[model samples]
Target: MTTFITNFLEVFYVLIGLIMLFAGIESFRDQENPARIGTGLFWVILAVIFAGAKFLPYLVIGILILILGLLSLFKQIKPGNIKGIDEKVAEKSAQRLGGWIFMPSVVLAILSIVIAQFTPLGGQIGIGISSVVALITAAVMTHANANTTYHDSERMVRSMGTAGILPQLLAMLGAVFTASGVGELTAKAISGVFPVGNHLLGVALYCIAMAVFTMIMGNGFAAFAVITAGIGIPFVVAQGGAPVVVAALGMTSGYCGTLMTPMAANFNSLPVALMEMKDNLGVIKQQAPVATVLLVIQIGLMYVLAF
Candidate 1:
């Protein structure tokens, strides 16, 4: 079962690579982007890494990642001209589909949850399987042909540009930080100023650290690992706090930071770009107050319940 699941994941990765390769090809053909070569090369490198990383040496992968960084540094990775959606066609489709347009998304969410909970394939495989199923559901509902679907998908991917890969890069950074004992260094630094055994202080420290780290990193999952290791386990959990509660609240606390940061391009910037909003920071502005309140409430809850 594990092997099967592993193989399924590999196939999924390859599919993703192929999609990225297609995006690279499209970028090369786009006359609008002045840096089309750089854009295409970025995606092609990413595609190669995704499809062939397992077979490649770690040093080779590292070099490829450096190349990607250099490309970004030189401002080569721009989102070229994405094909605009036809408004009349979109409106007609919207009128025809109405609420049913959301059905595929609903299926994707519910089916993923069901598979993860009920099947031996686990969450990773469940997500991959559910995504494909949802794609098929969307195709059937829209009565779309393969070419149309591919065109739409490619457009969306191109529109995302570098932000699409930011999460993966941040996650890798988290792993590298943890591996380098950054967590231990953090714990040592914080322990000097604030005593470790105080429950309220410990909870506050963990929660605040999670939020601040997430804000800096732009990813809650990335912040969770480092913060949990550095502050959560040592400061809160070790001090008689409930491990599970601390961990859970720690992550959500990080999400509060996600709501406030521009670094989180997918959550904050993507909507503005997609909707053509005048203010790029509008989403974060709206979310900030809510995130702040939630973070404070979660901190209180963690203090009360985790202990």
Candidate 2:
């Protein structure tokens, strides 16, 4: 029962992919849809990635990615909503729920943390189980119907359109970077340029590298795995540095990059388009100062504590 509880989150993900695939097909079949082909291609790529990834060979997955990459590069994706929620109804629900609307999320965080700290389920599995429970709590609290969860989730996917899967795709690219010896190559190159014996410079370099790489990658998460493997564990963690502090602070440094990069379209650009704002770079501009300050703070913390 504990094991089943831990591993069942995959079922939720599979359901999400099915929703995208079906919605894509629905759009493709509709004559009134403005972005039929683009929408279909976009969601099909997302759906196949999530649903078929478990069974598909790595080569086939790579080919699928190449195709999707070419399609995106050539401006072949667009949006057309096939279904969605009534905003007024949703607003009404939120208003009625009041403070309780936050209960599910609060419960999820506490449960995940507690289970991870005390149980053999492990942190990742604990979070997964907690997520499933949280969804149930949300469903019951909102008095949602059998199909409400599925339909509501699908509506969100349809609304986000092409940007929905940007984070996932970028994460895959990070994996490919790791597999292609980029991390090893980068480590060698950097080591040749800088003396790793100087602990202060080495720590600075590692944290800054994480931020710079994250900025380029558009995701702190994607950059974390690569940068940590390349420069983090080797120069900092192994050299009498606190591994946990260095890692946590290094990822925090990477988030500074997320704040300033346009490449993080989902974070920086999507809000502008969604809100119909005049300044395209407004979000990044606003976040830049805060990110820089926080990054400095992280660097200081790492220097003081990690060593």
Q: Which candidate is the best by TM-score?
A: 1
Model 2 residue 293 lDDT? Answer: 90
Error of 1 at 78 (Å): 0.4
**What total of clashing residue pairs does each candidate reach?**
0, 0
Which residue pairs in candidate 2 have backbone atoms (N, alpha carbon, C) closer than 3 angstroms, thus clashing? none
All candidates' TM-scores? 0.85, 0.77
lDDT of each: 0.90, 0.80
Q: Deviation in angstroms for 105 in model 1?
A: 0.5
**What's the lDDT of the predicted structure labeled candidate 1?**
0.90
Model 2 has an lDDT value of 0.80
Superposition error at 279 for model 2 (Å) = 8.7
